[model samples]
Target: MPLSSAPISAPIARQGDGADPYAWLQARDEAEVLDYLKAENAWQEQQLADQAGLRETLFQEIKARILETDLSLPSPWGPYLYYTRTTAGDEYPRHYRCPRPVDGSHEADEAREQLLLDPNELADGGFLSLGAFSISPDHQRLAYSLDTSGEEVYRLFVKDLDSGQIHSLPFEDCDGSMTWANDSQTLFFAELDDTHRPYKLYRHRLGEEAAHEVFCEPDGRFFLSCLRSSSERQLILQLGSKTTGEVWVLDAEQPQQPFTCLAPRVEGHEYDVDHGLLEGVWTWFIRSNQDGINFALYHAPQTDHSVPTRADWQPLVAHSDTVMLDGVTFNARAITLSLREGGLPVIEVRPQGLPAYRVQLPDAAYSLYVQDSLEFDSDRIRLRYQSLNRPAQVRQLLLDSGEQRVLKQTPVLGEFDADAYVSQRLWATAADGTQVPISLVMRRDRQGLPAPLYLYGYGAYGASLDPWFSHARLSLLDRGVAFAIAHVRGGGELGEAWYRAGKQEHKHNTFDDFIACAEHLIAQGVTRAEQLVISGGSAGGLLIGAVLNQRPELFKAAIAEVPFVDVLNTMLDPDLPLTVTEYDEWGNPQEPEVHARIKGYAPYENVRAQAYPATLVIAGYNDSRVQYWEAAKWVAKLRTHKTDDNLLLLKTELDAGHGGMSGRYQGLRDVALEYGFVFKVLGLAL
Candidate 1:
């Protein structure tokens, strides 16, 4: 069933004609509209009930399915130890202490069996849920932060491992990032006010009579610029201003003294400060409107009294074909550079005194993330790799010796056998000839007779959703439905070049990319227009809304989660926490050109009476990032404008923030709800 380019219905230029798409919709005055919404809501509630029932049955089925595979699963989790009280296998990894093998066996299952957390016989029992923890220089005491309530405020608590005694600092709110003072007698941490402003540095001594504020930045909007010295006696400050930032150096002992500015604020240039290995040597990455790219500067390695403002700073690298350095890791002899070159990742390990060595990973898919794991030392790096069907792989790479070992591999997906799973990378040219990357995944057993397909895309910011494997995604893979990702512009998948192609004025590329992906899927016998489903969350949800308006007949259903649909209006309101910070990301909507572009594509504002697909819009009640009302209004309008019979479901979570749940079973239940919808649409069993 190939789809043709011809319009499915006569084009009625106006939004609400008598033949208006929403002619059948029950308005607020109409009892049917309220009843219709009520009916759909009840149906969804029943679907949730069915999903819960299936979960109990599926858990056993999936457990058997997963264990039947040949892959090695990592004990299903890691260990957690806090002083004498140790507990591993909490619901979330961040909540518990990850236990390591005492003998460094690195066998997760064996280590789990050996490590034990004994229930204590004491009445006044307390457990330390480790947050950002650091060991003192002498290793006698350990300082860690833990969240007490709604806020992620760290309360500094010190534990004397030998005496099994814990002492609390005077401060109620402490910084997650804190380092011990040189003398080890004083502890330093930062604090933010109620307005979510950056931390002001404070110091606490073991026997101090009073807690002292060591330093504070003047503006509430600005953040702390404190960087500890090699001796920890002095602090380097990088004061952040609205437009730019300035660098300063201050003595720790002089609590209220003015800071000496090392680098004056550069107009239109965004600067970042990095403390170097040597004293007085700091690095700055500066991005400016004039330069059109970023540049790096290395300050003098040591403090020279005679030449305090020494221009001994050298230019290590300048903006070129590379978009910008994503991250930089420093070792004793070299600095490992991570940059996006033409949207692909390139890692360069340049020795300070020696030549640089470049290692390039294959570029067909995306790199989900590349982080230097603390488990390994300077010369060795642990990297996690992910792709469309390839579950994540953690590998350790040695820079000097050029040796690499696979530390861990995601369990082989039992639901999907590589031989039976088919995937392909296709490209579609937009109106501007920019080719969009589209990935499609299908089960070999699934026949191509208009089966339901689930497609996804995210084309905002330079955030690239690298192709990676996920075992959880197997829920969809096990079904006959196909899974897909649309690598549109605005994402860093191809790097800055691709991102620039889809942002602001050129934002149409994102919509076009999504539409193109859908068309390609239908054309390739994967699915028919009516059998396809598309989903995106946040900015990606914005994409879903745009395409639905343009081609509603193309999809069977849509899931827009925590979507940013009220783009045009939200951008104008600076009262939103991230709106001002996002001006550079999503253009200022006040600008004439930007205003017109956003108005044209803004999802909520552009709703029309058209034959639309069934839609499910989800939001979080406490979501400060994307307001709940945005989805509320969009659903309201969609109900009013739809031409034909279609279902629209709005689910709002009152329990959690941006991420839904804290418990493992709760999250699994959430996953089951979404997957159940797809299965029900595809006519699978409850």
Candidate 2:
């Protein structure tokens, strides 16, 4: 089936000022919108119908690299060793546990296995996602939340582990988060309002007929969440927005008491608290941005339950303009601080009264994350480390002895070798003379040739895109392609100042930085204009759309997934989900200046008569973040105005949300589809 050559008709203009021509597409369930999406789906399928064999080969290549049957490292919690395992054909993992031995051995006893939950059995034939899974303090009961739809609203369920019976709680519109009390009978959860914002906290007893609403946030800008402290002595409730937040604490031993505020929320002041013992004193470690753009660590005594102001905060670690304080975790013997400096993550461990030291890593460009510690009193801490060319390795570090051991290194099946690949960190100078970081990885055999290059970027909301391993990307590298990541300014790679320079009035820096990186790669002879392809998703999708409009002749192809291209219209509507809360990230368009700024760059508003490279745009019908209409409207406008007939395709997943299709095998198939499209455009062999 050939795609229709007749261009889509121009959208019908509305009577209001700045009215969108394609605003009618926003009616998701309307017949016309559904018809248009179905047509696009059919066209995409027809265009790639000849590559069915290649898609299958790519899928199998990715599947072969993963271990079908695997077990995660068991972490000791209470009297049991808890872990999850996946079977060969199952779509979800099964949660299991065994009694912890007195000898302190970290081995699972197969004969003593106890099954807590099996999602494969629960899901039946429909979509199922397991949300909050937590065990009671006594370890006799379990509370979990499940969402059968991809919309993210979940229902609560409790199970008696000893009796092997499950009871459904009479709660609706839950946000899928639960924190258990020390009594083992009470649980706290957050419930979403009509707009799908978590606005209320409720407490429920195991056998109660109705749950009690503990607190409700009156302010629409702030969202609520609940969690248990690491020490297991306090229940913490948090209310926060993009730039500010407040924390409240309740004594776990006294469930009847109301939560006390730790500190009142101040506009533009953000802080998070974790309880820990410092020098034998109960202390609160708060990571706050009150004194610096990049946060600082402050400590306060927990004895007086009164709210402490900024004046009472005593600095534990002063803020550094070069480093962004990410978070802090605690154990009885030490405190672990997660920080980002020079676009790389580093972990520092400080013993109760000793000096601090950083965790050692082999690669300059790699990603690191702290795993949950099972016990508060234990000295062992777990960390996950991975690089562009290396598989993930989970390590256990002892704070007392400074000893580290690798618990597991994810296996990459078949003849895979890390030595055959080369990964490097390169710098590109932006137009304003600021240095932008780029992480590149490629097969050693393709270094000198002018091969195809895949550049990826996302520079919004201070989110950092760190270097990590991807098994599916190997298919491209093996096909003589070089992959690179441009750590642009809107990201937190270079700290808060970097993010500030790329957002709001200075948003053009993001597009400028990306263009600079692409030119740098070409100047270095890594790839020429016709051999380059760029990709990004969500906000990054906005980046791809903006850059494509700015420099259409600079790349061969582009991919934008769930792109937020209709920014001006989205920000103008206050009734949309998450619109009010996102005013801090993207300026409020109700103001004339902000509206003009957004209109100047919004992809849907900027389409013109120009030739564009081959492009693939993806969307989900159920995506709440970026609506499906945004992509559909943008594609319609492009067809009407684009000067050249470059292959333009749109693929919409009917049953999925923001993230594509669910399940491991299904996700692999989606990647195969994307890789197949890229291969077809690049003229690569199957």
Candidate 3:
């Protein structure tokens, strides 16, 4: 294959203009930008052509380790037991349901299974994602949304379960979230604006030709979403921005009535609402951050169905300086709280007449995600748990007796033993004397020996990089490579204070914290500088790009997937998706001080003449969140400035978006390609 001989030139900037040379790349739909992306894709393919066989082998190994034919535990909803299953070689799962047995058994009758939706069939050989899957109150119709372009714009569809017929709603450019009224015939959904922001709400009745506009959020900074209350009594509309938000509620029985505001939007204050039966009285569980950064739980009676302000809320769970209240789940008998403290997640159960108790886990560093409680009157709460070495295990907790039972642990086929891997929690001191936690996993046989290490991180939007099990990562561990996660200050690992120290004017802390963690690993004799590879995607990709620019010698190789490298330019343009709403996160660039601060650390703006490490950058053509041009422009700038002969490659998925490929097999293949690149760079390729 012949490579382009055109010299990569830097875009000229006029005096005091602060203009970017590669800004032309933002015209994603233009011919010049498309041609450049295609050329970059071809160049990457040719560069890695020798590793084609290795990629295939890796893909096969990953596929073989996964259980091809599997069924999820049936969850009771109304009169049916619903579950999803996948067949051998199928790209997607098929959702099915069966009538609950008269004896109230958990098992569903296989002979009477009713298929709700099969994504493979719905795709019809095209890209299709099920964004929202909702069943009507009567269970006679299923309302779902599909996004075929991978751009996040969804089309609503309704299926008659009993008649075996499908109806396509006329709504377009929806955000793919819908709520059904108590009547079951009326549905509420949110629509996206021209900038891909969900700002409007609509109501459509069954068999209606048009949907009526219910509410519109005039402010561009706020987004809207609709949800049905767990009690099935109210239709709630949530309006939110990065830091402040408000909620509105409508009587489910009166679908035509206007929504009433629960509380006015107050800057820097955030709250979320969920309804439940508390002490024989219908109550609203409101999680608010007004009193403390970690958030506090408050409850109020549902009197006269009037919206209560913060003044009327009574404290249930006081704010704790050490523990962050992640979320709350409610049922008739008790409430389950997802709390994070000391960089680990814990489930606290508060029964009606008993003191709160925390669920015990076996791992030092692990993740616990609260699953949806399908039935509001049940005495059990379900959660999924996983750690660095253990696969995901679903467990059910009996509220009354405080007994917990493991429902299932994902099966990993072939010669895989969890006991062979060791998981550890270590701390790295940052530049400002902050102790950053690092979760590490490695093969027990290779412990205490210097080996290649893959460090992963994402430190933005208060998202924690928790310990998770990955069968694909097993390939690296088996090859004497260790994996670790840097719980830096930008994430919510240590609560709100940690995240506050890493965003806005303090954004540089994220990059500094990541570098400190990398240096700590080297100083502790865990891995040498030449054997370290760092990886992250999206905002995390920003982390990788920043650290690489600051200390390229500390890492041997780097992988950035759909990276948001052109931060200054992107933040300057409010028209871009997520730019306006993210003002509270990265700070509004319109302000002089914020602009100067962001420009100082923006990866694309910071690229300079230096010896860079081997790098692989991946992009999705239709990614709406972090535009593909950011990666394209960053790579172009890096190539123009970096003085290294080390391999630098950019591969764009023309048919995908931010999430990459949609299907299971395709996703695995993408991972294999990434792993193959890492292996080649490390001289471990077969």
Candidate 4:
């Protein structure tokens, strides 16, 4: 293993316990920092040297389960059908389109498919992430954005489909969002600021020499996002912070006109709007949290170019205390909503003149995602559904007849049986008597008693941690390992109130809830403390870090990927990417009370000189969110302070950012490596 040769010294960051000894790692550009990261990577490779075969087997298992040569369900747009194809041996999918069959068939013939963009060809064995892919309304041109360095600074480009001529735009940084005007000649995009916030909105015309700036959000806490309404009659620009939001709408027909505000910004109010035809009148449908913690749907009719105010807004869907209105989709013939009730997703559809009904799900704890249709009046809506034990299935629902058909089910290629695995929803009692949900999946046949279990969690930003199928997890499940997810309080699984209970000064609930779930799992004979393995990434990594500090002996091994461990220091620095915006989620540490509250659980500040479980942490050197230094400093501090000599390792991806390696193949490989580390520490055979 590599050891730091530089003289240890304290720096600016003052930990609650003492001065941070590893604060020097924050200087990312220093040669010493780079060398240390590389050394740590090499050390991690050596530490898992004997697991090469296990890693390979795990990788192969993951690869075999996935059908390499496949294509996504085609989506109908203007005059063409668009979809993506993934050929065997390719690291990325190829975008393609075909003319819609004149016979009105939902799917066009494969022979008529036209190639659009191939990431595999564009990447040329390097990293490439597509930020935006927008086809103009005229269908004569395509506008897209690319991020080549994984830093998320995308460059915009316009391509003439017929002439095959591509024109590059001058903007080097974008927020990965683009919208076209009714004229199709005017294109709108958002530019990122120095802090990586999408603060500027601009308009660029085809065949024009200059771009015009439309709007600029001066407040660091608020970022901008723009999109065309479903009616294609309104251009919407939304400025949002963590706890507050304000929406502005422009007349799509008059692209040069300024936008009008629907409501003034309120400190605690957040709302989103979309255009639709309500009762034959063009209307703005909004989902707002003004009336209740869970959002409610409201609509305001727009008879002309005159914008409507909050006074014109009328209730459409009343806010419910038990259900959360996650999102709303507007269509010509129907209005669908994404809702959550009892910690499960519910799709509520209100078709014209007909009553509303919730879509039935296959499992109690499954994942649901809606793919908004391009055609506003399309009668069918596409949705993707999956559970821990089931492969993802794409289904199309007919709004007119209340009927649905399966479009595609992600093929599990290798030998597999759906009945082999069982999924259950369980509840764990938190220390404060709150019931925390746990989604579990395990093989029906057990080879041993109280087998090894892999527990995962992420409890921040009101983001619910939903269960979904993972082909790679089969490697562990087939080897007698059970997997579970702790839907703790910080997550919005139950609703906005649940999320509020886990953040800010109440952040301790997130850690306590996680610990409670672990204890409950052990008490129920699902797994023993000595055979349990916990894992989380990003904010969830923060959860794991805090829980480990409070109760390290609860698990056998743990994995923290891109952890936000240095919370105190990061929040204190307002210039960081999300620091200012994060003040709403985690209170501003500038206030003494807030500082003490954060220091109470901010992982890096709270890490003690106590015994810790075998741990492996993975970080991305180029991550804009949760910078690499947090993980590096945390590991360095643990190495110096921990009393036990338990195995501790760090792996940094030199070329990737927060999401890790870009390609699908590389993503699976990363998972295989992480699982190999778990197998090595848990004494499991490949």
Q: Whole-model Cα lDDT per candidate?
A: 0.61, 0.88, 0.89, 0.88
- Judge candidate 2 against the unseen true structure and give its global Cα lDDT, from 0 to 1: 0.88
The window of 10 residues in a row where model 4 has the poorest summed lDDT is 6-15
Backbone clash total, candidate 2? 0
Residue lDDT tens for model 4, 1-686: 23443313211122334476777777777877787887777778777778888788888889998999988877888789888989989999988899987877767578887788888888988888998899988888889888887888888888888887889887667877778998989999998888899999999888887888999999999989999888888899999998899999998878888888889998999998899888787888989988999999999888664778888889999999999999988889999899999998888899998988878776879999787565898888988899999998988888867687888898888788878998999999999999999999999997246989999999999998889998889988988999999999989999999999999989999999999999999999999999999999999999989999999999999999999999999999998998988999999999999999999998888888899999999999889998999999998878877888678888889888898899999999899999998888888755
Per-residue alpha-carbon lDDT of candidate 2 for residues 503-600, written as tens digits (9 for 90 to 100): 98988899999999999999999999999999999989999999999999999999999999888888888777777877888899999999999889
Structural similarity to truth (TM-score) of each candidate: 0.75, 0.96, 0.97, 0.97
TM-score of 4: 0.97
Model 3: residues with Cα > 4 Å off, grouped in runs: 1-18
Q: Which residue pairs in candidate 2 have backbone atoms (N, alpha carbon, C) closer than 3 angstroms, thus clashing?
A: none
Candidate 3, residues 24-47, lDDT tens digits: the string is 777668776777777787778778
